[model samples]
Target chain A: MSSVAIDLAAVNKSYRGKVVVNGVTFTVAAGECFGLLGPNGAGKSTIVRMILGMVPPDAGKITVLGKQVPAHARLARAGVGVVPQFDNLENEFTVRENLLVFGRYFSMSAREIEAVIPSLLEFARLGSKADARVAELSGGMKRRLVLARALINDPQLLVMDEPTTGLDPHARHLIWERLRSLLARGKTILLTTHFMEEAERLCDRLCVLEEGRKIAEGEPHTLINEQIGCDVMEIYGGNPHESIELIRPYAQRIEQSGETIFCYAPDLDQVRKQLRGRAGLRLLERPANLEDVFLRLTGREIEI
Target chain B: MMRMTYGAAMPANARNWLAVWRRNYLAWRKVALASLLGNLADPMTNLLGLGFGLGLIVGRVNGTSYIDFLVGGMVATSAMTSASFETIYATFARMHTQRTWEAMLCTQLTLGDILLGEVAWAASKALLAGTGITIVAAGLGYAAWPSMLYALPAIALTGFVFASLAMVIVSLAPSYDYFVFYQTLVLTPMVFLCGAVFPITQLPAAFQLVAALLPLEHSIELIRPAMLGRPVGSVGTHIGALCIYAVVPFLLSVALLLRRLMR
Candidate 1:
């Protein structure tokens, strides 16, 4: 119980009688990074909001850092940090003023916030832009500033929803590095991302949700292994239906989407060899990744 | 060491509404010059154009010059527009466009605390608008010095009344477009009907009954006498009416916001 940072057991939520989250359960051990991966309207935001104590679940219980949620939400939120999906920076204030103002939300006085501003700016690599208006900063700088602002209280757990969604590769890598440092210092992170590469890289364990139900939960590697086997042959730019028909016999599982057919097989080399001389086809064989597991579980078809 | 993490746990916040107010204050500071001028523009035009243009046709009203009679009404309505505009435009931006309030909710603050902060901030802005006109009135010698200061509490309470009322509309508003109905159908009509321009007695009997029910009428009643250095009347009833406007809509707004946002 002491080691568990967040526990949502049989949690259920509904909106206007529409079941948004139905009997979902997960636990994040302290000092571990947990990822919640789902497509749009799969109830990811609903679950995140409930955990932050914004909405009460229709059924089940949620405890965060040992405090009951939506009841002790304030006490729980006081110890938690959040990096929202959007940067949501205050454009009206200077970069430094943004951090200064946020401290007061935690009941910290201006003077206390002043003492922390310099160090927080340094953490964000934004010391030079301290007095600059938020509108003046680049997208990357604003994101970093938001990341630094979330740490004003030095929370025990950090809840980040799509923290690096719109950043360029250089910026996203920088954010990833900052997150790695936070994790190294023993902060438990609850992450939700559509980036399978990010989940593969950063998440120690993750859960995939389909239509508000927990479809699969395990370590990324284990999920890839169990759901998608060892390798996948991605055949694209030909005819996916015909490519799928040709590879269906040897592939463990085949999912065709758009112009690409993902053939997940225990031995995809056989499929690769068989397609060696096929005309008008593009094929690449690689180790099955988290994207393969995610696609296999949630399916490649568009969901509303 | 410059290690700036303040991880020390503390008691839950009780007065962090001030924090929310301070944020609005900081945000407003950037556009302070333009906004103050905007608030001044409405009453200034009415004071010059209507006070002179319309005042000539209608001579002394309530035993005073036409423009002087309008002074008290202008002060009351300045607060009305200030509180209403602030609540509808600025507060709505924070809630919808900027998502500032949404970010605030992610912190230790509750919906009630944020609402209080918005109310207090709107009231403060209304107070500024009301005071600007009061100073101009005193400068023009239409209002008594220091006595006009007595109207300030009434000004603030008017702010509370209208700002909270606007918040109720804000809680119900689906988008920026919905605010126009309240602005035109509700607020713009209140100006003409609430005795902000002419006396309610000048209004028909049916209109007077409505003017009696609205908070602005009671406000102008209290504030006009105070601004003119006249002996005020109906003190208890007026204050009670204003208090009802301030408290009920405030409570209703918080409840409605909890329903709209928390869901």
Candidate 2:
């Protein structure tokens, strides 16, 4: 009954001499919803694989559910559930049969699995399609079924890797609501995603990773406020150096890239007054969010 | 912070492997009738075509009807074909196309559990195919009913050997087309050269030596004697060779698949 559900100490991994996860250390407490946010190739999936014992780390230690990883991964995994990034549902089986067969994988008897199938189908909003073949179900339905399948064993620790990556807004919201209910029931969740909004909505505490290194770790609001300030002002079509000099006196920080310059400040009015009526200059002001903090820390350059 | 300990570390066990087997069974049950018919058709056609067509001219080669001699070979080939198809095509579909193996890995099932379960399922399919042909052979009056009962374990062992060998091939295969190489280079050649259709004595001295080393030849050797109620020659050596075929490839398959799937 360790307070921490997952602990990674100085974990490192590489593929053919290219380091993917470098010197990463983090702990997820029991019943906490922790998020790992990063761009593609930032090693989010690699970390998830290491936790699942699918891959061994080249260096350092990992422990899940109080058991040392790899050595005790099976024991730990028995109490854990995972929803992988890809749709791995059995296309050959019907919706209910998919759950039924997956339940057996967790060692649940037919009687137990049958008993829960109805309720789990209802939970996934797929009660109407219980007998529908997986190929017949829509993409949203498939994702929901995958989510329901992960709960077959009522796992204590739920690991979801980019659970809402390819879904529509409607589907994403439904999944988020279901996840919230799971959290209320006191299940620890370790999630990874590229969507900053999803992390902000679901994660209790999150870490931002860039190129296999941790850039920032804290509560969402704290990271936003501490790193990027209260508000962000985007100024377009202004001379970069002049705008920087003009905004520098009033701004806490200024980030200039291409045609746009971002001004982070305690108050937007002071910076706004200086740029007011300036020829060909347009200003858009909004409250800072996790995306701002993410961009500021990880940079605006697209990671190839 | 309170710390808890797991009661025991569960290694790869029979229960987990059985679960994998059950999953495949449940899925296959949807098309069970069609699948059985598909499995039975090939062997029956061979029995009828070769038994009647070739038997007319050749008559008897070993003091028995050509149909009776070919029955034992048909049983061995059916087992090998069924097991090979299951492990290569069906298992590959689960691993690469359907991602069923990846799904199983997320649960309590280990890679070892998945591989063992796959082999067991393939062997079961082989048993079904071989047993069906054996029954048909009995109906055609080519096999003694009492002696045919003893062929069950031999057929099962044949299935396991071919299934394990197919698994080893699958672990290295890059695409579906890669299977053609195995089918051509290994399976087809063995089907003809392993005394499945004709006696090994009719071959050249070198080929006869080659046939003696093959698993299918060992399987047919054991099966032919048992089905005919004749005293099995060199029983120990044939059984020993079959055991080696079943076991060595199985271990190799496990090692290779573990490396491929477990990274």
| Top DockQ hit | 2
Reference contact recovery of candidate 1:
0.58
In model 1, how large is the Cα lDDT of residue B96? 88
Distance (Å) between predicted and true CA of B32, model 1? Answer: 1.6
- Tell me the tens digit of each residue's lDDT in model 1 across B1-263: 11101121112355878998999998888788998998888897888688889889999898988888888899999998899899999899999889998788888987778888899999999999999988887888878777788899999999999999999999999999999999899988888998888888888899999889999999999899888788889989999999999999988887777777765
Expressed as tens digits, the lDDT of each residue in B100-209 for candidate 2 is: 98899888877777877888899999999999999988987889879888889989989988988998999999889999889899998998899888988889999999
Q: Which portions of model 1 show Cα errors greater than 4 Å?
A: A237-251, A301-304, B1-14
Candidate 1, residues A142-224: lDDT per residue as tens digits?
Answer: 99998899999888899998888889999999999999999999999999887888888899999888779998999999998
DockQ of candidate 2 against the true complex: 0.47
Clashing pairs in 1: none
- What is candidate 2's CAPRI-style docking category based on DockQ? acceptable
Worst 10 residues of 1 chain B by lDDT: B1-10
- What is the model-wide C-alpha lDDT for candidate 1? 0.86
Scored against the true structure, residue B14 in model 2 reaches a CA lDDT of: 57
